[model samples]
Structures are given as C-alpha cells and as structure tokens.
Target: MSQITSPPRKARQAPVPAAGPDDGARARRVSRLKRRLTPYGFLTPTGILLVILMVTPIIMVITYSLLDGVITNKNPAFIGFENYAEVLTDPVFFKAVRNTLVFTLTSVVVHFGIGLGFALMLNSPLLGDRIKGLFRVIYILPWLFTVAIVAVLWRLLLSPNGVINYLLGATGLTEGQTEWLANPSTALAAVTFINIWSGYPFFMISLLAGLQGIPRELYEAARVDGAGAWAQFRHVTLPQLRPIIISMALLDFIWTTQQFALIWMTTGGGPIDATEVLSTFTYKLAFTRYDFSVASASAVLVLLMSMVLAFFYVRHQKSRD
Candidate 1:
C-alpha cells in the first residue's frame, strides 16, 4: 500500500473545466432577449391592428376635425378649433345630443324592465319547459334578424294603411288609418318601441344566464325562513343579479345611443328630426352637407360622452365589487 502511494494520487485528476465568463454572459443575454421578444411576439398582431384600424382612424378624425371642409385632398389647412366652435354653437347638434340621450335612456330602461320580467317568467318552475323554450326562441329570433330587415318590416307595418293600422281598425280601436311613422310625436315613440323589441331579447338572454347561475339552495333557504316570493326576490335574486343588471344596462345604453341603422332605415331621422341621434346627425353633416370637419368634431363629442358614461359604469362596478 505504501509503495502504491495511491497510484500518484491518480495523477491528481485535473479540475473540471468551468463554463467561461463570456459563455455564461452570452447564455444570460440570449435568455433575456428571448424573454423580451416573447411578449412582443404575442402582442404584435393586436398592436398592429390597433395602430392600423383604431389609432390611425382616430388620428385621421382628429386631423380632419382641425381642418376646413375644402381641405379634403392635398395638404389640409388647419382652422384651429373652428369646427369645434361651429359644432358647439349649432342648435341642431344640441338637439341631436338631447335626442340621443333620451333615446338611449328610455330604451335601456324599458328593455331592462321587460327583459327582467321575461327572465323571471322563464326562470319560474310553473311554466312548461316546452313553452319556455318556444318563447325564448321567438324572442331571440328578432335579435338575429338583420337591422335592415327589421327596419323594413316595421316600416311596412307602420305605414298609413299598414297591417298595424288594419289590425287597429279591425279591433275598432282606431277610426281609420294611422300614419305612425309620419307624425313627429309618434315617430320617436314608434322607433323607441321597435328598438325595445329588437333589444330586449338580448337583455333577456343575458339576465336569464345570470338568474340560472344562482344556487337553488338560496331560494329554498329563503322560503324555509318564511320569506314570501316577492321578499325572496327582493332579498336574493335582485341582489345576486345586480352586477349583471348594471352591466347590461350600460351596454344597452351605449348600443342604443350609437344606433344608426334602424333609425336611418326606418325614419332617416325624419319627421322633423324627431328621432335624430348623434350618429345620424354626424352622418348628415359629413355626407349630406359635406362638412366633414364639423361631423368629426361632433363625432368626437359623442365619443367623449360615451367614454364618460363608460367610465362611470366601470367605476360603479368596481365600487360594488
């Protein structure tokens, strides 16, 4: 053993080579580069789309709003707030704002109310399952129909001697034919009704989903605690559905406020602009009058109002949460 001397200590095996400093640094740098590029690679499509579709259009609108109507082609000469001044001063624009608010609020409220009722009815065990399904289908059918088709159908029905007037006459409710869409007073109301009809089903489906998500145990517990039907609804269902209700109301407001196709196709904001909302007004300004700057200014104002409403809605929801 002593002679062996551990075989010269096995030649004292050479120390294993460690990675070079530059190699380690290079690996770390590659990892960091990959980490940096991964998120950007994922977001690249969305960023590009926003830049092309949303940001570009918004910038163009703002640019046009600052220019004169005659500056469509070539270099646009900035008028420096003249368009804003005109829009703010215009009575028609103010009227359109008022009408838009009224339409939005009224439609939202009515739709919510009717849709909530229908949702409650459908959720009831007393109703036959087949009947509920049939009703749901019927209600949702209108929502699936194209806006142009709905407008045309309603326009035909609201004509002076149309089906509605015919039915009213048959029922002895009216003396003769009625021009529902022709009269200014009734035109807005009629359009509002049609909007409600088309929109309520969406609210119904949404609220029904919310309602069905609630646990049946809650209702049973409420009943066991001697809560009546109305009390149970007041204490349980309404509370549980609050978030959904508020969100749907806000969505309905935005949709109804910005609606153009139905109103344009049905009345063209006619009957003396009784049904004219901001969208229609903007369209008339830009296309009919060829005042793109004023139109863009008005559109910007509308966008601001929508943003404010949305901000409040989101804040309210967060606070509730």
Candidate 2:
C-alpha cells in the first residue's frame, strides 16, 4: 500500500487557454486568397473584350453559314447547311483547298529548314553578340513590314522590269527577264518563296529562344560521351527544340493557309487558280460574287480545319507529356 502511494502525484498542470477565433490566421488565409484571386480580377476586362470581339463574330459566322442570303438583306432565310453543300460541291473550293494545303505545307517546311539553319548559325560561336543582334534585326525586318506593303514591294521586285529581273539579267542568271508572279508555272512558287522569306524569321527567333534555354551542361556531357557536332545536334539540339518546332510549325500552317494579301496583290489567284486559297476564295465569294452565306460557310470550313489541326497537335503534346 505504501509503495503504491509512494509515487508523488504530479501537480495538476493548468489547462491551456483555447484559441480565440484565430482571427490572425483567418486574416492571413483571406489575404492569401485575395492574392491568388487578384490576377483573374485583372483579366476580367480582357476576357469580356475577347468574348465580344472574337466569340461574338464566330457565333455570327456560324449563324450566317446556315442562311442563304447576303448580309445586306433584311431577312436572311435559313437554308440549313445548303450553303455548306454548295461550298463542298464547288470545284473552285476543292482547288482552293488543294492550293492552300500545298502552299502551307511547302512554305512551313522550307521555313523550318531555313529558320533552323539561321538559329544554328546565330547560336554558333562564329558570331559575336553585336553581329548576332544585327542579323536578328535584319532577318525580322521583312516580317515586321505590313503584309500589304510587303506584297506591293515584292510585286515591284518580281515584276518583269523590276530590280530583281534586272539583276538576274545582269548576273546572267536568266536568259531574259522573268515574271515571278504572272506565269501560272511560277506564281505559286513565287508567292511561297516570298511568304517563306517573310515568315521564317519568326521560326528562327522562336527556335533561338529554345536553344538559349537549353543547358550548356548537356552539350558538355554529350561531348564527354564522344558526341560530335552532328551527334550533339541530332540528340541534344533537336530533341530540345522539338516542342518549339512543332508549335511554330502548327501556327505557321494555320496562318499561311489563310494568306490572302500576298497572293491577292501579287497574283490575284493568278493566270489560273494556282494561288487560290480558302481566304482569297472566301473573299471573292463574299465581295466579288456577293455570296455572303457561301463565304461564311467556307470560313466555317477553314475554322473547322484549323480546329482539327489544333486538336491533333494538342493530343500529340499531351501524349508526349
């Protein structure tokens, strides 16, 4: 009994006070929530603007595509896909689609090739920083020129009596002056080349940014493992730049497919339909032929094509991740 009671009872500790509402912690949590939510608050105006400008127009186009009258009429009769039927059956529509595919594919391929080459050159040690900056400016200058102005400038250059033909004659590169944009055989090629020249700089800049982001340590490690220039490029460089290349190519395809100004101003879809693309075709349908519903249907087709491409691209990116 004495042994059982021998252990002195420890003094009962005072009960700790309960937290009073934790107002400071709640205030901190509320502050954090505000910080996280602030960006969306700032973006609300721009979101509203895009909804008004982009979404509203897209909806209008879809609605108009179902009708069978020009916008000038007070009442546009809903034809229910007849406009799409007309567009699908029109031979010119098929030709325009073919031309657009060919132009976009060829231009984007060449753009990637030439742009990657320039990016490599710029990233090389051969160029000093100042030289690199100068070349960058020179390459992007043509792209920065408004396409309308570029179209006019290139028209002058490609004309039979212009500086390009004169230079070709002087250099003995041609037997005589050649029309780059007039002849059916040369119109598509000439337009594709001009577009390539103007647009490749975008790819170059994008690829160069990707290149700069790649760790130099990777190249060093590859070199330590017996990687040569080609080996390093094939393994290290290409893999690193693949995402940028794909994204740029996707965007270029979409944009180049919609090319109107250059083709219209330079060739006007030409001696034949050599340069006719969906954009110019749609334009002709709307203004020249005064068929607004049909034009809207064609535009809807263009939008659908772009969406399909984007879907595939996004799927590919997700699979990679």
How much RMSD separates candidate 2 from the native structure? 10.1
Best by TM-score: 1
C-alpha lDDT score of every prediction, in listed order: 0.89, 0.89
What does candidate 1's lDDT look like per residue over 150-231, in tens digits?
Answer: 9999999989879999999999999777878888888888998899888899899999999999999999999999999999
lDDT of 2 by residue, 206-300 (tens): 99889999999999999999999999999999999988888888888878887888888888887678888899999999999988899999999
Flag clash pairs in model 1: none
Per-residue error (Å), model 1, residue 71? 4.4
Question: Which regions of candidate 1 fall more than 4 Å away from where they truly are?
Answer: 1-17, 20-29, 70-75, 316-321
Task: Give all TM-scores, in the order shown.
Answer: 0.89, 0.84
Query: Model 2 segments beyond 4 Å from truth?
Result: 1-40, 313-321
Give the C-alpha lDDT of model 1.
Answer: 0.89
